[model samples]
Target: MADSTGKTDKDVAPQIQATDVQVEKRASDDESAEKGVFEHINLNKNISARIKNPLADLSPAQVLRDVEEFANEHGLVDVLPALKKGALVARDPDHYESVPDMTPEDLTTIDDEVTHKWRQPRRLYFTIILCSIGAAVQGWDQTGSNGANLSFPDALGIPEKDNPNAARNQWLVGVVNAGPYIASACLGCWLSDPVNNYFGRRGAIFGSAVFCFIAPIGSAVCQTWPQLFITRLLLGLGMGLKGSTIPIFCAENTPAAIRGGLVMSWQLWTAFGIFLGFCANLAVKDTGDISWRLQLGSAFIPAVPLLIGVYFCPESPRWYIKKQRIKEAFESLRALRNTELQAARDLYYIYSQIKVEREIAGDGNYVTRFIELFTIPRVRRATLASGTVMLAQQMCGINIVAFYSSTIFEKANATVTEALFASWGFGLVNFLFAFPAIFTIDTYGRRALLIFTFPQMAWTLLAAGFCFYIPTESRAHLACVALFVFLFAAFYSPGEGPVPFTYSAEVFPLSHREVGMSWAVATCLGWAAVLSITFPRMLAVMTPTGAFGFYAALNVTALVMIFLWVPETKQRTLEELDYIFAVPTRIHMRYQAFKVFPWWCQKYILRRNVTLEPLYKFDGVQTRGDNRAVKE
Candidate 1:
């Protein structure tokens, strides 16, 4: 057809070449289209990289280096992809804009918000009311014994604080408070199952509430000091047992992200209870016969609402899942989350993770579960770190400050009312600073705060000790003590106080967390009990300077402990941590060797701190209900 106007075949060949170029371009386009949606190379790999690298490097140095080279060589091409292509793609402006961006379709609202909602949900509201009441009881117990030395003589029919028989009253007052704390360590663990199974969290809490209610009333009616001690012991048991359950219930019910903060409300309320008792003391300051019994008895008032309200609250979804009541578990999950579909998704997600943890933990008896918690290297490390931090927390001279504030102030030459007022400042600072943790903990993170603040606390303690040792009754000495004391309390409230409990709750496996926490609490109480008993004796022997010096050294040790141990738990989910730590692969590096050490020590003990990678990797794991993969 072109021949009618054809100039030459060569010109026709040029036209044909153009047509061929078009066909080739179209073929390339079709090939790319068939390959589909830009071929995402699994961002999952990027997230899992930290987990994988550690695993690949296990063994002898030669083997590790060889594996590293192989991985690096093989990874070069994909890892070095062109940045231009990544920059070219633009996200759609409108696609996700309308989505409400609800808390995962699987996750529920946190406890604090749920407790504070405009039309408060029944479970959260009731739980808060119950916990608050329990906290108030705890407050009463802690504060009831505060003025015991002053009034015990009258209450117990002793003639004076120095009565040879006064040891009985002193012992009753101090030891009685400790009894529940020690008993709680065992009872909480032993009773958790029955509480969860025979009765729900609600029922367990209700029983504890009943004890709180009765113990206080009994405390008021006791004619003999022994009777008073027995009642206080019962109250302690209730508080300890019930207090252990709060972390469990709060942690299990809330989302992983904010669970730590929510559970901390228990302590916050505990402080508030102390504050209330202070108020009560102020109210009754002038009344001579304002019996210690009446002060103790007032603890029961809050329990009335809790005893009545807790029965209406929901059971733990974790507990339900443990019992294999999947339907009821899902129902509980939904009620907590405030939706069915999302609740089911979260339930399934948690249920699967729980299944994984159980399998990884292996088949074992109850005692074995206890052993396994500490047997795994990673979990054991976490447990040791948590327990040590707690140890440091108690010995950091805090409880001494708290238990003997009046005495300490008096020794510094302050009057009784002035000492009490200064102690009030300590309480006020504690309460105020604590609220910031609720807001910033999830943001600034647990590890950063602990590490940064502990050193500050150590230095403050050192300086305070120096101030005390200066041999002065000057106002400057008193002022220095006051500043450091308040600073120390502020540091403890946000950093150590809530963090140990939060970290311990987060790190331990769910199956063992209840018992582990019970024991951990026991350790905390055990150490505090020891220190409290000995502190008075130490004060008598060493005087303030020696005692403060001893505690200041303890702070230094705590700082070192925190440095050597303590991994970051910020923004990590409980399930991910479990899988990460289970990996058998970990780097065992002895940074330096001390030549004179025993061969046995060299064989079994680390010469210096060792950094081991997690035993396993769940870096790429994705929950069924959430798109986000495991955080490394």
Candidate 2:
């Protein structure tokens, strides 16, 4: 160093500053790398402000060309003429006369689709009703354990009555109660993708219904607690598979406008089944030693109708389309809808959307689809949103009441008979309140209902927990406990209960739907299993006060998760929601925290006249897939 000069090589270096002109470059590149999940597919750089209507940009000529290309691609030449008119109507329903040779009948059918959206085909109702029956099977069967929890342990030699090993017996009772959920969480839910993939939705439902039928009979005949547990596990297998598929089956068959209302039939009927289970409990309670057996056995009755009726219902047309059974898909859609014109439009539109969805997937097997649920940006958001809602269901603690309401009532000093009656009240309140959701879910939207109801649930549940502290001698104690529990159910049934399944069913793209649903269902039942298995011991240790309080706090946590992550899915079609989920989670959170929340406080709290800026806009930059139509 001394060879160059007295000042060493360090002193000879060029003067440099920490700041640089290139400072802006790398940061942007890093940010882009993170947010580039939907870059090629998205029309707008601000994916938070997503565009709806995938068909919004196509001109009349382009629409015609797209129809021609689609027909040629699918070899649908025989119905090409009908397909053309259908596309024109879908592309612009108001200008149906623009469709060449458009008939008066077409006008009436299209007008009816808007004016009388509920006037669906007979087969569609049969399909929805059948799917609802499957949901009822779970609700009714779960409650069978609720009543049987009183007597089964005694008959099976695992009584939780006062004894040195009563805690152990309590744990055993919890285990037996949890067996169905355990199997469902670990085995049955995981099986959904493969079963649905190989056998279709109906095959999955029918196979599950068989188990739903047999497992109850097996539970009734069990000589030991272990045998009863095994039988319940078998029931869980059926429940997990059916639970994952039924909502999807209902959502796929129903139209967009009333999809929320109709799909929520799953929740409505499940509540009804719970009421029926309580009725069954009371009906058999006077049968002496066989009362628990009868309570457990009666669950199979609901499953019988599901097994018989699923065959009569139309299979989901989306399932048909997924399998490339195009003609069958068209026929199923036609059977589900009132007119061929509507069917053709829906058929072509779903096909177009599926084509785009598949392109995003870029060819994959079941494993790959599951992986893409988190890997693909648009799909990852749906996965997160669905996962949050599903997990929140368990956290909100409805199943605790469903699984142990009678036990909870008894713990609060009500007699066994009084507890059963109280639980029946809870089920009734849950069922009766669910009716408002049918009208409100579509009007108020999924996220809105959840946002409004969660705080009410939190307070009501906490109030129920506090009721545990009231003196046993006071009649008001039991009445107050039951009242608050009923209030909790009243809030839960309409909002959290229906939204999870309905929202999850619609969130994922078709290619990943089965696997996504499998994940969602697994999350729900897995937590339910955990909660059910631990609850008896928890009741002994933490007491009803702490247990209810735990879930009450979770309601608030779940609300924050819903507020930040869940998007508003009101009347948006399945295809349009692809763009909604494409929005980044961070962007959504920022909008909520800074913009939406502020606007709410201003307009609602402060009574200001300020107009709130909307997150989703109708028009924007066009996707590459949509742009191709225009260029062609």
Measured by lDDT, the strongest candidate is 2
Q: Could you give candidate 1's per-residue lDDT for residues 1-632 as a string of tens digits?
A: 12212234355334332111111111112223321111111111222222211111112222223223332443422312211111111011011122233244212332222233233346754555465566667655555555443465466675425667655544444555455555555454356544655676666777888788888788778787767767766776677667656666766776655566666776677667666665565555456665556656777876777777765666778877776676566567657755443353355446545654653455455577668656765556557766877787776777776566655666666665666666667666766677777766666777667766777777776676667754556778777777888888788777776676667666666666665666566667667666655665566567776777788778778866665555556545565455334322222112111222233254558564444343223333322112322321
| Residue 423 lDDT in candidate 1 | 64
Q: What is the model-wide C-alpha lDDT for candidate 2?
A: 0.82
Alpha-carbon lDDT, every model: 0.56, 0.82
Query: What is candidate 1's CA lDDT for residue 91?
Result: 15
Candidate 1 has an lDDT of 0.56
Model 2 is weakest, by summed lDDT over 10 consecutive residues, at: 19-28
Over 327-427, each residue of candidate 2 has an lDDT whose tens digit, in order, gives: 88888888998888888888887876675465456558878888888888778888899999999999898999999999999988888889989988988
For TM-score, the strongest prediction is 2
Q: Model 2: residues >4 Å from true position, as ranges? A: 1-40, 43-48, 72-75, 93-98, 620-632
